[model samples]
Target: MSTAVKNQLRVCLLSVQYNIMREMVNKVTFLTSVGFMVLNNAAILAQWFILLRLREDVGGYTMREIMLLWGLTAASFGLAHILFARAFSLPELIIGGKLDAYLVQPKNVLVSVITSSTSVSAIGDFLYGILLMGLCGLGLREWLLALLFTVTGTVIFTAFALLLGSVSFWFLRMDMLEGQVVMGMVSFATYPDGIFEGVSRYLLYFVVPVGMAVYDPVHVLVSFDAAMLLRVLGYAVLLTAVSAAAFYRGLRRYASGSLMGARV
Candidate 1:
């Protein structure tokens, strides 16, 4: 290849790296907010309840590693707001028929709505993530890779939210059911992926991907297994594609009445 071509590829990779760094900073901010909002005010032993007990029960884990893991857990939830902060409004828009206005707008409705609101709740997650990164014995390169895992995991989880929210167009009347299911998925992904057994584990990791969002990616972060990390990338790609396809399919079925469907 030409020297110019090599330099161009190098610059492109650097740009991508820069963007990832900026996003990690954003994730850090989101987790930080969550700490101030919820975790910080709670008793320190809440850490014991939410974090320490798991290490004791699981064995072969240290308090420091547990703290990093706990921070990851917090950051995971914080990053979820990246999708859910907007997902929360979809049912209301559908119910009120204001969704029609969005349909007529000159921009992508999802883009507009998602951009219009953000989950500040994610700030807590970001706070915890930075702390977790600081606890590492790993090099900065390793730390950056972990951030990539967390961010990719965050995107996959948002895809989960998008999948759930898109269901509104189908049942219209079933938004509550949709919301409950998404929230339930939230419960599933909040903890480490290792804790579950058998079919439930299969469901979260491959079938639905909630556990992959935190568990597999975090596992790769903790262990530095290239093969396992590659598997996560594959899962992320497949899940994102499936969710996007599902959302567009649901979009075709959307029926905005004269706000009449909701009144009945």
Candidate 2:
């Protein structure tokens, strides 16, 4: 690898470690938050279990496939928040002039800003996803595929959020709209892909890109198609490039908040 690439990776790893340590300072509180989050996800998953009992499948997704869907979604969401929690806060940072703190750092501004925070509760989600995968009886090969899917899914989720949040650079007070769009993507991702048809299916595949993030992964897990896996990887690369470009392009229009603050 190139020196610059290695350096950037090192910075990212250090930022993640620091944020995790900061969150863990209050160990009891962190544990409680994680526990509650896992329970909450379990409660939501219970509804699916109940629904599946009444019917054989929903939209051609058997209970096993649905389990994979939820597993991937939770794992991806968890990974995104754990690593790039601040991506979701980009709009507020831009509007409130919080970017000044990150911009002053020697590291990549977007990377520094996003990695500055971690969601402790997301630990539960990550754990819960693994539990669900086990419950669904994923073998070693399936587990490896799921892991790859989770990473790609994380990339898609973080990139989409950053892309939406970047709108704050051009418009005023767009945080709510961006937030809703992201929530919509997350909400839609947990359901069976077969449920949506025609225009809605297209929107899932392209507009929100949940198909690439979650559905396609689920399909690959079920059938193991190389072409589909390549498409998923391709979309992740494309979205990452687009979001990073948008962030840097918007940086030119960024007006520093000049707010005094210490990161450490």
Candidate 3:
């Protein structure tokens, strides 16, 4: 692509970013956010109620314990999006044909893409995540460990999401693939990682990357173990570096799906 063409695309994406930020202040965004918060956190609550009724039947967890876990996990769920929804939207940018515009932009495409979009719903998740973090039950040192792990978890989640999203450049159905993967991650996220073990635990922990978001961090926090903290922190940094490298490598292959470069 030519220089003038590239600059024009960056300018256009910047404009879109500004418009999105402006729209964030409106009533419509507020109401939609309220509705989704109700929906997203509903399952944990409903389960909490059901568990309370069946407390005698289920041997392991009490009503209060389940509720506490739900609240804790829910908060982490919120935190993940709050910190990295822009990166999470990488798949959408690819599928929505927005990437076609981004490719010609003079700025780094990843940076431009992030600036151009915001997941407004992330704010709701952020509020709840903070609540969970407080109650995860830790001494000052353990709390510090949890905070560190939470930050580490964010890095892992963002990197995992981006790696998955970047695959869309090669696959046509970016949204479908992204939705499936994200849904899988969400399904495992709030639930206690203790239920799965051996091979099952192995899958989530090392293979799929979902365990990074909740299980590993929660464990490290509860135990205040130095080794576990280092392990998770290492995964966070290493995975993030690997994922970013993968993204830029894929960016080089992005076709832009245009033969003539028509847009101004």
Candidate 4:
């Protein structure tokens, strides 16, 4: 790589390190928030145990498979929040004119904004993901597959958030729209892919792609389909391109809020 590119990466990494250190300043509060989130997630997973007891499976997913799905869901979301938490609040940043600080920076605006802060609670969710994977009795290969899926899924989740939040550049009141899109993606991501059919299924793979982030990953881990994994990775790349294009295009329409503030 060129020296300039290497320098840019070094700056980004340092920025991320600073953000993490900031988050760690209040170690007690950070640890408590992370621990509570993990417990809350576990409570939600417990409902699946009750449901599975009443039937062989729900949405063609066995109990074990469902566990994997939850694991992937939490892990992907955890990574997104940990690294790209600002993407989730892109609408607010734009609408509130908070992008001005990032705009003045020499680095990539989106990356700088997203990596400006780290979500401490997400660390717990990531640990829970590993614990759940162990519960699945995954072999070394499956564990590695899960890690790959988590990485791609994290990128996809962040891109999707950016795509949805970019609407604020055109319509300033996109908070509701962002919530709907994100919540819909999360709702579908934790379920079996077989449950949805027809257009809904198509939308899952295309519009939102929660299936690719969660279901397809789990499926690939279980069966190891080269084509399917490639499709997931390919879709992530395409989504990322689309998201970046959309953000920059909308930036042309961005009216500065003129308020100087950093993302908290």
Cα lDDT over the full model 1? 0.61
Top candidate when judged by lDDT against the true structure: 2
Candidate 1 per-residue lDDT over residues 94-211, each given as its tens digit: 5566566557755455644433345565655566666665666667876787677767766776676676676676666667776777667666654555567889888887666765
Q: For every model shown, what is its TM-score relative to the native structure?
A: 0.71, 0.96, 0.75, 0.94
Off by over 4 Å in 3: 1-20, 35-43, 52-76, 95-97, 100-107, 135-139, 258-264
Candidate 4 backbone collisions, by pair: none
Q: Pick the candidate with the highest TM-score.
A: 2
As for lDDT, the candidate ahead, 1 or 3, is 3
- Please give, for residues 33-106, the per-residue lDDT of candidate 4 as tens digits: 88998898888887888888998888888878988998998998898888888888889888887788888888
Please give the CA lDDT of all the candidate structures: 0.61, 0.91, 0.64, 0.86
Candidate ranking under TM-score, highest first, comes to 2, 4, 3, 1
Error of 1 at 63 (Å): 3.3
- Model 3 residue 150 lDDT score: 57
Off by over 4 Å in 1: 1-35, 38-61, 82-84, 136-138, 257-264
In Å, residue 31's CA in model 1 sits off its true spot by: 14
- The superposed Cα distance between candidate 4 and the true structure at residue 239, in angstroms, equals 0.3
TM-score of 1: 0.71
